[model samples]
Target: MGHGTRDKILIAAATMLGEDPTAKLSVRAVAARAGVSTGSLRHFFPTQRELIDTVVAGMYTVDLPDDPMQDTASPPAERLVACLQLLLAQVGTGESARGYWRALHAAYVASPPSDDAVHAFLAHERLAVHYVERWLVRLRDEGALAPGEPGHHARFLLTVVNGLLTERALPGDLTRLEFEARTLMTAASAVLRPASSDRP
Candidate 1:
């Protein structure tokens, strides 16, 4: 296949993944979606494993804005609430969020991911942590953080979010999920001292 054909396949695969993170990116499926032949898809990706690994690596690049804290005039609590929303938004939203987590849980139950999958998963996680740390660093720079390492505090808040996602992945219960998410975010914000309380 030509490079143009290969680009079509990759674009189609990325679109499918963005819509559904656990999309089965089989060559045949992606080829059909891309309106290309399986042979053409294989010409570019070479193998299903290669295709998946490449897609995961591409998807793992989640970056934060240089200035994630958009409103310097807002109260520290309000700024933190915005940060928490940004962090949770990374998990995704609506049916996409539910489907993403559901697929991940199913994969865990059916079979473990391969070594490449493990590496890609770790890369995704590290990127997420870095994104969160950026927000925490912003808060610290604004003198809105409690006296402690931003990395440590960011990890603690992320741990709480993960715990909520794990313990409360109730099927067809988006309302409860939203409530619990807000409650957890509130708890996360509570860890931060008021702006006035920052160390001189």
Candidate 2:
């Protein structure tokens, strides 16, 4: 019964994240969603950071839908660009992007984050980098990309993504999507260099 209740809480939290990327996974919110008492939630996850980390860690094994990396027919750069687009699509633009940043600030930036909160944030960031590295490794092994440290390459791509996320929240030109696509294409091309097909 203890294990079942814990699972119930995790499922409820995950569902909330899925429904809204900006949903604040507060203890009370999760408990209410799980149809469990706050005490029950606290029993399994003593802190909001623990609950968030557990739900995100659980998601590590779940494959993303329509992963473009699996599409071998496309050039490596195009495939990677598509994958990055999938990430960007989640945050969206304008109000949706603003909402996400606001939630993020309220959770981790409004005040000094607890150590556990910092750890959770770093873990999530590393997981994102790991996913990108995996795709880079596959491309390298298949001779679609130049051989190099995939981790470094992944971090570079993620940095570009970080910049784009900031841009998404601010007022932008009508060609935002086009600008994003071009930027990603450039980044992807740079990372896949020495490959004839990857040339800009």
Candidate 3:
């Protein structure tokens, strides 16, 4: 499907932000990147804050595939892993992706609590929580998660994932991708199948 002007603007903005984390994201810069005039951009986003809010909201609303846990065609464990992998892939160590994340984080930190920014940040956070909740619910239905508090477990796992992503971004003794994935899988498996004596 053909993306609209606003969509194109958002995409261009995201691409530029991803390339240069410190980008100013000015009307002129975004317009130039999108190959649209400032007037065209202003038609959709009247202000810089409006554009930033839309981009943040857009980040959360992006679609993912249907839950694999609900799909009987695939093994539950494999499906869970696939879902986790999808989340990881989004914030992986790719230069562009990392740059985008850094830029977003910097903006969040620098900006004061405006209604637009707060709304978008809350929306994005809720989306992340929702994504994890869905996965946990599906796993619970598939008998992977134990009885009691699936939402709590989901939140905990999501927090862990977020922490790992932060660590990956910072300078430190970075964990290898394989090791990080394995660690998450092992922790999840332990939480879901406490009865199993095997440990990673």
Best by TM-score: 2
Which RMSD values do the candidates have, in order? 4.5, 3.0, 5.7
Which scores greater on TM-score, model 1 or model 2? 2
Candidates in order have lDDT scores of 0.68, 0.85, 0.69
Q: What is the Cα-based lDDT of residue 187 in candidate 2?
A: 91
Model 2: worst 10 consecutive residues (lDDT sum) = 191-200
For model 3, the stretches where C-alpha displacement exceeds 4 angstroms are: 1-63, 66-77, 171-175, 195-200
Worst window of 10 by summed lDDT in candidate 3: 190-199
State the displacement of the C-alpha of residue 118, model 1, in Å, after optimal TM-score superposition: 2.6
> TM per model?
0.64, 0.85, 0.60
lDDT of 1 by residue, 57-126 (tens): 6645645453437678877666666666665665655565666577877654468876655654564466
- Tell me how candidate 3 scores on lDDT: 0.69
**Candidate 1: stretches off by over 4 Å:** 1-7, 36-68, 86-100, 147-151, 171-182, 185-187, 190-193
Looking at candidate 1, what is the lDDT of residue 84? Answer: 67
**70-113, model 3: which lDDT tens digit per residue?**
56687555666667667666767656445656667776776665
